[model samples]
Target: MLQEAVDNFVTSIANGEMERSGGSRNTIMAYRNDLGQLCSHIQTLGITSWPRVTHEHIGNYVRHLRDEHAYRPTTLARKLAAYKSFFRYLSQKGVVTTDPALGVCLPPVERELPQIMTTEQVQTLFQLPERDTPMGVRDLAMLHLLYATGMRVSELIALDVEHFRAQDAAMQCVGVRGNVRYLPLTSAAMDVLDRYLQHGRPHFLRDASETALFVNHHGERLTRQGFWLIIKGYARRAGIEALTPHKLRHAFAMHMINSGMDLGSVQELLGHAHISTTQFYCQLASAQHR
Candidate 1:
């Protein structure tokens, strides 16, 4: 019965307005967990129908999450978004006339300044010995492209061979929500990418591989988890503390913004459909100005 509701919700999402959002399978699964928890909690309180849910019931569920389950503010906020989305789904389907989660509030979260590597630190990190080994060459290209383009890890991994134009010094990539945008590559990034494609990638290929820009030792397209593990290894080798792939993106955005590129251009380059989404980086820049 609960599975049916989840399936219906997901189907509606697919057939309805959210179809254009290009949400991933992982995001849909998260919404399922969140809505399932709310439904279970409501059922435990003897409330079964969606129409029976009220704002107070929503508050109770949030309290239960915070006090009983000890969810963090960010987790709580995500759960709230999930619930809101679920109710919105219900409203669109005429299951409920009112959206009970509409007025529900999320806990305030502090927006902290994003960490970025200095230009010198980036130079030093990229200067590590290149053994002409496959992994070494791939790592060099990966780090260079990350900082150069400010692409998210998922976007980077999704890159295809045809998306890049070597002679034109440009690449087109899809961002979060599947919006495609073009970026002009720096000379340094182009050099590393050229080397990786010509020499390094051929060494990694097995039988009948596809046109993915980066591949693992097995000659398969790299997974997000695989990329993270590789990045962790490289960060340790470079003697950089707590370095993750996103820090490179932060460094890229920070450097671009600080170099006086307007926020609109940054937003477009990052393929953020909403200006509000891109504004967070501006907040990070402002914190540094303080």
Candidate 2:
């Protein structure tokens, strides 16, 4: 009887959710799974009717998920959402006097720390690209600059050839909304940039007037998505499970903070609008040392 009610409720919402979100079969399946577990929990207690299930029963079930099952806060929150939706349906159909799941709050979503690669892992990724070939030279330079400056992928893709002031060994980075910052590059990164400009960039630039620093095979400006694909390919080759442009940026910030670089300077280099944003990396660096 509890299973029948669960099925009906899931079927009722599945169509509407699918129509609205498109391809929401997975979400509907999650709701079904949540209610099935609820039914199993109450059945073990000898409760048979939908109306016999009380608010206390719901609380016990949630506690069981948290304590016995050891579900993460995120998974618990998602289950709570499913519970609320299910009880809301039952309340509307007069099966329950009140919505048991309504007043129950979702678990707080924890903030995930940034993913940082080890110095050895960073070296492994950087060394994957063949420095001699044009594509390899371009990718290697971009990877080095990302780790060197902690710049956003958007800023990396938006780079222009003139932005690389090789004479100063610093990049003239132009951010969104006309904001500009001079990102000091390592002498090594600058050397690669010089090589890319001389041997690599010229080979990629089909249009003589093209000003973009990085170009695709079609000779158009390289996109953020393109850079992401490049990173993923190198990561796979280097045997890293997960890699993204932001991960590289996070790694750069972590390394800088670990090296005793002041948060203010790191903030300036990364072009962060707030000092608070830069402070998170300090915690990461401290935890790593401990």
Candidate 3:
């Protein structure tokens, strides 16, 4: 029965249900890893099915992850979140009558300020992508768009040509709950996008019907992994450490605040559902000024 539950979970992932539910591949993999360990632990306790698992079983599993495996608080919290989500999924499908992982206590996670690149570092990264070649031009546009819009990499890759309103100098992105937010494009980013469309994108266009704003050599929409590789390659060339999309996003917010953009404006531009989420960048901006 343990195997059956695991199989069902695997099937859900394979069927693209997770992606349809707005889960990224990386996130789904992390959930899979966390739940796999929990299933293994449950099997040792003579529990085979999710229906037979009780809240006590889940509580012991958390303690085991904390005490026996010496998992850090953040790791423990993430694992418990995966367990709760999995049990909730099972309950919804009638595989379990009750969500055994409900109301489980999770370890506290200490918040850390997200990492960001200095202006000098960003300049170096922007200069690393060669301007004379198609791939380089594409990479440059991607990097500039990321920094300019503060778009999450997921949203960045999901973009299509129709999303951009060139006449308005704006791009509309689908945010939470299918609501759309239009972000004004900076002159520099707009110029780069124009160059990419006119010169660079055509080079990669294998399919004339492809609607993706960014495409690989095969003319398919760029995947998140593909974007990560491109960013990491440039980061290494720029001699920057620990650079990521989230770091660039933080950099965008902090840079905007330093440049006198108000917090509320930045929140709206970033499509943040909560103003408090945008306020964290204010904290970073204050720290930097100090």
Candidate 4:
């Protein structure tokens, strides 16, 4: 059956009803529903069986839940746990050649970081902006994009519309001596960017000729100082007097490291020219967790 594994995976965590997984009965039921929804989704992609599922398919499903349904990080984490269990069972039974859900990354757990914003603080700052106003929309976009990309403030302000790839949900960053890197956007960042591009940017544009993706009240490319003020304004409102763009970048790097992202991947995402530059985050994460 196309949906057989979804059903079997319910008690698969325990191997059978007699054995017990630490998860409660309700969690097993929730896992069953989660896998069932995923199966229903993939079948629409013309797959007649679970054996055809790929890592790409699982990634797309996660992105769909993120971008289309706007699932929160905690909710996504639960669904990912369900996927991992179901796929583990599938792989053990030879129903699939390999585990397709092995690569799905859940959010870094909430933890205390010395001299860094906690996950709750970050969420507070992100949710502080009022999205209805043009400036607010732009601010939220910048905040989300900055946190999502871990880009320097100068780089963020330097972006043009052409640098963003809407279909892939990524943005290009040009660094020293014309070095170029493309960074993937989080679904939250993508959603805010789309809203800013479609609704907010128009209000700030004095001329159609302006190509800057982010603009100030005068309809010109935003300066680093301008971005500084915008961020400070929000931070002050949130009672965070010491906030800076670099702090956000630091949080992004260390959180990824602590969440088990490889150092090479972190280096690439941060556009660090040397792996050595990215290695400190490992120590930093350890220190924070300690």
Candidate 5:
């Protein structure tokens, strides 16, 4: 019966319930998976029914996810969100008297000031890409756009050829929440992109109908894992430890803020819906000057 309830909940998520409510396919799947994990954990507690699960049981499950599963804080936060939503649904249906996941404080997440590369470090990293080869040209373009636009890695990989306004030297980046914004590219970045499009992309193109701006060797759109490997390789080659694509984004934000760009403009450029999110870079830039 417990498994039946869990399966029904997952089915609801998969059957357009969440989709109609603005949840993406990825998001709905993630919630289903997270809740499934929670249900599995509950079974281990010898509880066969949802009503038998107490608030304390949910707390124990959270601790189990943290200690035994070694889930990261961000991941844990999402799992908690899933738990809350699921329990709220159960409560509304009279399956449970109260929301067990409610009033449960999340583990504190450390908001570390993002790491950023120095201008010299960025220059060194950019030089490591082998521009003589197709893959090299592609890497150069990806890396250049990463730093030039401060876009999230997901946004970078999702870009299509049409997204680039080559005449204006800008690219349109799509946010996870469906917000779209244009990011201006540096002349140097634009030059590398032009070279990659003309010389590199055609070499990797296996399908004439593919529209992804960047493609892997398999001629498919690049994945986040693939880009992570690429960035890690270049960072290692540049002799920079702990550098990530996100650090490049941080570098872009810091550089812009330090170069006298206004906070509102930086917020817009970074596609930050909140000014508070962009303010952190200002603090990072201030610390650098100090």
Candidate 6:
């Protein structure tokens, strides 16, 4: 029965149901990991079926994760979400008459400030060599755009030529769960975008792909991995140690907070569904001011 449950979950994910429900590959993998951990815990108690899961079993699993595994509160919350999703799937499919994990509650997660680059460091990062070479030009634009808009790496990669309104100094991003948000471009960002569009992109275009805004020399859309490499390269060139793409996002958020934007506005700009997620930037900005 446990095997059947796993099979059903996998099949449902593959059948586009998960995507329709706004689940990404990362979300699906996380759920798989969480459910796998639960099953492993259940096996320790000799329970082998979805129907055999009891409230006591769910409680024990949570305790085991907290007490034995010492998982962080956020990790525990993610695991709980996985369990809830799995059980919901089972109930929807009529494989389970009742959901044992329905009443389970995740522990509260502590809010932590993400690492951000200093304004000076941001300035230095953009001081990279301005060469007319394709790679150099693309790297400059990528870094500029990231810092300017605070766009997630995935959102940047998913961008298409049509998403930009270059004449209006804005670009629209379809963020998580397909929510569209408009990002007003900074002068620097607009300049870089203009240069890339005029000089860099035309060199990369091919008949096979035309819609993607950022492309490699091979004319394929710039992948997340490729973007990472570009970021790392620029970091090294700028002599900035331990910098990552996310640091740019952190800096952007904190800068906005420091500039007196409220949490709700920042949340909307970042495409966060919940204002609580954006509140972390406020904390970081306050700490920096202190």
Q: What is the per-residue lDDT of model 2 for residues 1-290, given as tens digits with 9 covering 90 to 100? A: 78988888877776674235432567888988888888888899999987887777787788888899998888888888888877777787889887767676655787677667888999998889998899999999999999999888889889999998888889999876578999989987998898998999888778999989989988889987788888888888998887888888898888788788888999988888899988988877777768
Model 3 lDDT on a 0 to 1 scale: 0.84
Residue range 1-290, candidate 3, lDDT tens digits = 77667667766866766446556566768877888888888888887777899999999889887898898888888888878878877877889898888888964677777667888988888898789899988998988888888888889888899998899998888875566889888998898889999889999999899999999988899998899998888878888888887888888888888889988899988888899988888887777678
Q: Which TM-score value belongs to model 3?
A: 0.82
lDDT tens digits by residue: candidate 1, 159-209? 988998887898888877877888889999999899888889888888554
RMSD of each: 3.9, 7.6, 3.5, 19.7, 3.1, 3.7
- Please give the range of 10 consecutive residues that has the lowest summed lDDT in model 3: 16-25
Q: Pick the candidate with the highest TM-score.
A: 5
Model 4 residue 72 distance off true place after TM-score fit, in angstroms: 41
Clashing pairs in 5: none
Estimate TM-scores for all models.
0.75, 0.66, 0.82, 0.60, 0.83, 0.78
- Flag the better candidate by TM-score, 3 or 6: 3
Better of 3 and 4 by TM-score: 3
Overlapping backbone residue pairs in candidate 6 total 0
For model 2, the stretches where C-alpha displacement exceeds 4 angstroms are: 1-105
Off by over 4 Å in 5: 16-22, 63-75, 107-110, 174-180, 235-243
Candidate 1 displacement at residue 151 in angstroms: 2.4
lDDT of each: 0.83, 0.84, 0.84, 0.84, 0.87, 0.83
Positional deviation of residue 274's Cα in model 6 after best superposition, in angstroms: 6.4
Model 4 lDDT per residue over 1-290, tens place: 76876766665554564235355666767887788899789889999888788888999899899899998777888898878877777777888888889877865745334377778878989888889999989999999998898888878888999999989899998875467889999999999999999999999999999989999999999988899888898889888868988889998997788788889999988888889878877767777668
Worst 10 residues of 6 by lDDT: 18-27
Q: What is the lDDT of residue 178 in candidate 6?
A: 92
Q: What is the lDDT of residue 93 in candidate 6?
A: 85
* TM-score of candidate 1 to 2 decimals: 0.75
lDDT of 6 by residue, 40-120 (tens): 878888987788898778877898889998998888888887777788888888878988888888657876666678889
lDDT-superior candidate, 3 or 6: 3
